[model samples]
Target chain A: GQQVQQSPASLVLQEGENAELQCNFSSTATRLQWFYQRPGGSLVSLLSNPSGTKHTGRLTSTTVTKERRGSLHISSSQITDSGTYLCAMSNNNAPRFGAGTKLSVKP
Target chain B: ETAVFQTPNYHVTQVGNEVSFNCKQTLGHDTMYWYKQDSKKLLKIMFSYNNKQLIVNETVPRRFSPQSSDKAHLNLRIKSVEPEDSAVYLCASSPDWGSQNTLYFGAGTRLSVL
Candidate 1:
């Protein structure tokens, strides 16, 4: 069973638009991570924000540990961002993953 | 920048054959993990190793074995390939065992069993 849940299993956005992805967990997580994967490609670590806000490039990740919720905001969506955004959490040694948010950017 | 490397970006083998996938981490992280992605785009954790101890997901078959020679390398060995094993195997490493540690992942090895 999946312990982590990510909303909008699939999303499509126009070029230059903004997009937000949500991740919620069923259990308290000691650490939460966000990753991006291109179709039939490798995964790139986007951020590791457990209970705070973090930013890199055009991506911003915010996490609220108490609420077991996290969000990723993408500014100026591009075709390169069209892929799967995966959310994973770890508590102790066991790690769990959400299905993922598939994003498609239209030009 | 730290990197995790997985060999055999793509592999095809016949059923009953043995195959092995290798993983290496140059980040010198203490934790490494193996995840499997099905055709449905669902990713599931297969195994996790922290220096010494190995944690295996209960759903994984007995034919799937994970071997770690050291802290920087973790390898997956399949005793007998099966059609059901055809999927993507991703290798990832973390700086620590903590939940907040960022995971650096390799591109992945796509396996196809005929």
Candidate 2:
């Protein structure tokens, strides 16, 4: 079965630090999306970077389609950024999601 | 603007009880889907509806069924739920079936079966 794996299962960082989360998939995909889930909150679409690099606010995503890997980069992290980051890839039929990387930013 | 919305943010019930989760999308998408996130936070696809028609079944158990009143609404109903069914259910919608389109997700319903 095809699977998406997220790295570091958990991450803890200090305020103003940087964090990077990696996502690797074993299937061929043309589209990949990154999402953020706050504690007891809804999942928010962060970036849909199928390939190359994309930046939005404090977050940046880089995806290498050939390598079947994607990474989410958070710069100068803040307490509010504490949450779970999920990675998903769209196959021909359905989209598969990773277990997600839990992030905890401290003050 | 929130394109997707789910009702009953939290639910608690016992085994053998029947429960239904409703999802609505204002994105005017042609495809809607239901996903389950287990305790380990592994999100898995259960059902998919495209233009009010079932497209993907994923060998889902008969106890779990997805119903759509219209293109904008897709609901999931479970009969005789079990403890293993306790998980977060997510509703999502996309403009089309193509990979070029991104999905919009709802807050999700957290279910706990005792």
Could you say which candidate leads in DockQ?
Answer: 2
How displaced is residue B12 in candidate 2, in Å?
A: 1.9
- Across A41-78, the per-residue lDDT of candidate 2 in tens digits comes to 77788999789999999999999999999999999999
Best by TM-score: 2
RMSD of each: 1.6, 1.2
| DockQ of each model vs. true complex | 0.73, 0.75
Interface RMSD score of each model: 1.6, 1.1
lDDT of 1 by residue, A1-107 (tens): 43899999999999999999999998888888888888887888788877899999999999998998999999999988899999988777656778999999999
Error of 2 at A79 (Å): 1.0
Per-candidate clashes come to 1, 0
Alpha carbon lDDT at B24, candidate 1: 96
Off by over 4 Å in 1: none
What TM-score does the predicted chain A of each candidate obtain versus native chain A?
A: 0.95, 0.96
Q: lDDT tens digits, residues B1-114, model 1?
A: 538999989999999999999999999798999999999778788988888468545478999999999989999999999899999999998887765567888989999999
Chain A only: give the TM-score of model 2.
Answer: 0.96
